[model samples]
Target chain A: MELASSNYIETIGFIAAFLTTAAFLPQVFKTWKTKDVSGLSFSMLLMFFVGVFLWLVYGYYKESPSMIMANTITLGSAFLLIYFKITYRKK
Target chain B: MELASSNYIETIGFIAAFLTTAAFLPQVFKTWKTKDVSGLSFSMLLMFFVGVFLWLVYGYYKESPSMIMANTITLGSAFLLIYFKITYRKK
Candidate 1:
């Protein structure tokens, strides 16, 4: 729980968190580049979009910068996907 | 920001969240049933597992039960996938 540890191993979790999370950067980048979300899962994105929004609010309530920052980026990317989802919806 | 309003639309976010997230249940059940995760993405899981773990801690720090419960379940499911990833290592 003491992720604040000063040791290198202590930072592994943070590194893991960052690395794993940054993995989404590619998806975000590609999505931004193409603005194509036909392959993305609408149901999945819709669900997590709200979940992340709630978490963003929760983070605000708690005043945790780490949570706030991550969730914000997550929200942005998720919203983009959701927007594309709505845009490309079948008429 | 007012998720506690108790209106159906207010609850839509929660329901959307539950449904979209629960969408993973089928994959979890399938993986559990067959113990086959070859189709799952290891890099994706690893990235998400650590991300979810950090989120859990962040949720705990914030004393938000909603965040805690959801992230805990996500972490558990992600860990299972991670286990499968390590287990099925190409040795």
Candidate 2:
């Protein structure tokens, strides 16, 4: 019973991780397509990048596969946001 | 030793949680201040809301205080973003 319960919880974690991580993609895509980032904040991307990096480190230290995977994706998205902010800045 | 190690890991998680969750604030503040969201994707915010809500549920099921706190804060930020997007739409 305990094992089954743990598995269930893990499944929930994975689902949550996938959802949250994937959520950043549409913004990334829209930014690429529109080439507009006036609505996006640079400070937020920088802070988010650092935060995701910490989460990645936390995942590794804790040996959580889901956390690691989710954070990797999130980190990538955060980086892209930063890149977009820098490249798409209005002159 | 094992208990101490677990506590250390939890500390990391909390730190990661705090950073990741709080990272959204700058965007929220910027949006409110600028009243501009043309660069902010509506699809992303919609997806993010669902994801954060799921994370909150997962946190509750796992009894993770950090996750719960982080997701709750994130949810608020995500909601704010959504609200900003709706309110600041260009006519």
Deviation from native of the Cα of residue B66 in model 2, angstroms: 1.8
Candidate by candidate, in order, the iRMS in Å equals: 6.1, 2.9
Q: Which regions of candidate 1 deviate over 4 angstroms?
A: A1-20, A29-39, A86-91, B1-40, B83-91
B1-91: candidate 2 lDDT, tens digit per residue: 3433667766767887877777777778888999988767788788788878877876676666777888899899989999989999998
Q: What is the lDDT of candidate 1?
A: 0.62
User: Would you list the clashing residue pairs of candidate 2?
Assistant: none
**Cα RMSD for candidates in order:** 6.5, 3.1
Model 2 accuracy (lDDT, Cα): 0.78
User: Which predicted model would earn the best TM-score?
Assistant: 2
Docking class of 1: incorrect
| lDDT string, candidate 2, A4-89, tens digits | 37667667678878877777778788888888887776776776788788777766765557768888998888898888889989
lDDT by residue for model 1 (A1-91), tens? 6444334433443453475458566776776677666556777777677777775665455444655666677777788777767876656
Tell me the TM-score of candidate 1's A chain. Answer: 0.66
Model 1 clashing-pair count:
1
Which of the numbered candidates is closest to the native, going by highest lDDT?
Answer: 2
Worst 10 residues of 2 chain A by lDDT: A1-10
